[model samples]
Target: MRPLKRLVEQFLESEAKGGILLFVTALAAFVLSNSPWAQAYFDLRDVYLKLQVGDWVLKKTLLHFVNDFLMALFFLLVGLELKREILQGELKNPRQAGLAVAAALGGMVTPALIYTAFNYGGEGAAGWGVPMATDIAFALGVLSLLGKRVPLSLKVFLTALAIVDDLGAVLVIALFYTSQLNVTALLVAALVFGFALLLGALRVRSLTVYMLVGLVLWYYVLLSGVHATIAGVLLAFAIPIGRARPLPPHADGVAEDPELHEAQLELLEDAAREAQSPLHRLEHLLHPYVAYFIMPVFAFFNAGVALEGAQVGSIALGIFFGLLLGKPLGILLFSYLAVRLGIARLPSGVGWGAIAGVGLVAGVGFTMALFIAGLAFDAALLDEAKLGVLSASVTAAVLGSLLLWKTAAPRPS
Candidate 1:
């Protein structure tokens, strides 16, 4: 139990550090883009790369590769986290989950409405999805800096809210952002995804089998005119999280038989390893890589467009106001409505002040916002989109962090 607790602490610490690294990398990329060497940066971003495996080939620009391939991996991790949370984590409790679920829904809808209002029936209207995301890494990273000033309940609330927000974004991308679908490719992907689910239902435990099957699934999904990242989520849902049982606690005393005690410890550790679900295992294995590498790379590559010649239309205004104003308003209003209607209550040790602060934190939609913007807008409008994302992210981070800093009291001396 102690070791598990320690591991959770270490994981959060590592994630916080990773988020900081992502921010720094993004800042560097943004600076380089606007600098005199902007042409070189743009050239590298636009440079095409190719990979071939026998009869099949994949060729895309450096930016496309990062956004499609790497971000798919990022979404895979997100999907795994979502699964675990729904099954055993904060989302498992119906009452506690209600607040977050409602808040996340409001957060997503409000941002889209705000963006739509500004760009209605215009060329930028498609970008309504731009501000609908909440980057959990960036938001949680800010909370980590507050230490015990923030309550664990508030953090848990935020985590659950972010997970729901991610699921919403995934649906929006799949339903609204897809292109002309290829029927044959769609059929193939559906069949593969179904087979993968059958394998999970049969309790297949070999990681290699799942990965191989997942590669095929990804290929078909990518070819089916759906965003490639949705493949990651579908694969995640297909992976089995086998049933887990709690181990019996040992009596707290010196053992009469030393050898027996040592054996029990070994057996317990082995049980612990085997008891973990494939979903949990994959999530643990992939989180660090996603945090430290994939996300940072995606941010650097996707968020570096020059701001000088940007198309500063209603699209920019829509995104900025959506994130800065709409996110908090939606979250706060919906949450209170839920409470008033007897749907959910505030978590223990949390107040409306903390919820408000968390609402602002939810506005830090950096990585996902940029990714969706890339999908929503074409090259002509990308620079403006990136500008709005970058500016809103920074401003939200400052406001959210400050609000939470004041709302959450410091640890007792």
Candidate 2:
């Protein structure tokens, strides 16, 4: 249990660092997009890259590769984290998970409703999912800024809530953002997924075998038009969760065998340490690359919105209100109701004001919002949505920081 707690602490620290880097890269992208080098930056993103295997060829812009392939890796990491939490981390306890789950659901539903209210029956209606996300990196980064003012429990609550929010966004992408499905490709993907499951059931602990099969599954899912990132999630569930076997009790004649008992206990401890599964190993290995490189690159490629002709009318307004107003309103409302109805309770030292502040922070929906907007809007309206996302994210971060700063307790003397 101590080891697990330490692991969680390490994970949060890493996430905080990565969140700061994400902000820097995003800021840089915004600046570069508005500078004299804007055209060159755009051109670089638009450059086509092709992959060939004999006569078979696939081509896409550099931006497409970043979004489709690299972002799949990002989602894969997310899936692994989700799996870990469900099996061993925060979500493993229903009492602890209830608040985060309720908050995430409300967070997603409210933003969609708000956006849909503004764009109902209009061309921008499909973009309702755009504001449903909470950028975990940005949100955590902001909380980290407050230092000891905010309670550790509040930080953990926010982190867990954001993760649940991410899961919701992934589901929306898989369900709504997909193109017309190709049955043949989907069947192939299903077969591969079943095989992967079979291997896991057989306790096959080889990472290479799982990865090879996962790549094939990803290819099929991509061809199936189901938003290839779903493949990442599927692959994650196939990873085995290994644990050390419990030792049998000592024989009756061994009543005085203290040395043997101690040695057995040591062996058990070592075995348990080694029992960590492939899921943990992969998550540990890939977190830095995903956080430091893939996400920053994704932001650089996707966050460069040209503001010259950008409009702030219906689509933009919907997005702004959905994030700024809808997010906090929903999170606070649902959380309050949950507590009132005995469904969930706030963490110790977390008050209504702090929850409100965290909800506002959750409104920093940059990366996922941008990804969904790209899928949901046409080129003409993409910039409008991007403008809204950028503005709302900045506004949320500032407002949330100020609110938390004012409401949070001072550091211990």
How well is each residue in 254-333 modelled by candidate 1, as lDDT tens digits? 35698788877777777776777788788888888999999999888887877676777799899998998889999999
**Model 2 — which ten-residue stretch has the worst lDDT?**
246-255
Which one is best on TM-score? Answer: 1
Q: Model 2 segments beyond 4 Å from truth?
A: 244-273, 410-413
Q: How high is the CA lDDT of each candidate model?
A: 0.86, 0.87
Pairs of colliding residues, candidate 2? none
* Clash totals for all candidate models: 0, 0
**lDDT of each residue in 301-354, candidate 2, tens digit only:** 888888887788889999999999899999999888878878788887888999
Q: How far is candidate 1 from the true structure (C-alpha RMSD, Å)?
A: 2.5
lDDT of model 2 at residue 239?
A: 85
Q: Model 2, residue 327: displacement in angstroms?
A: 1.0
Best by lDDT: 2
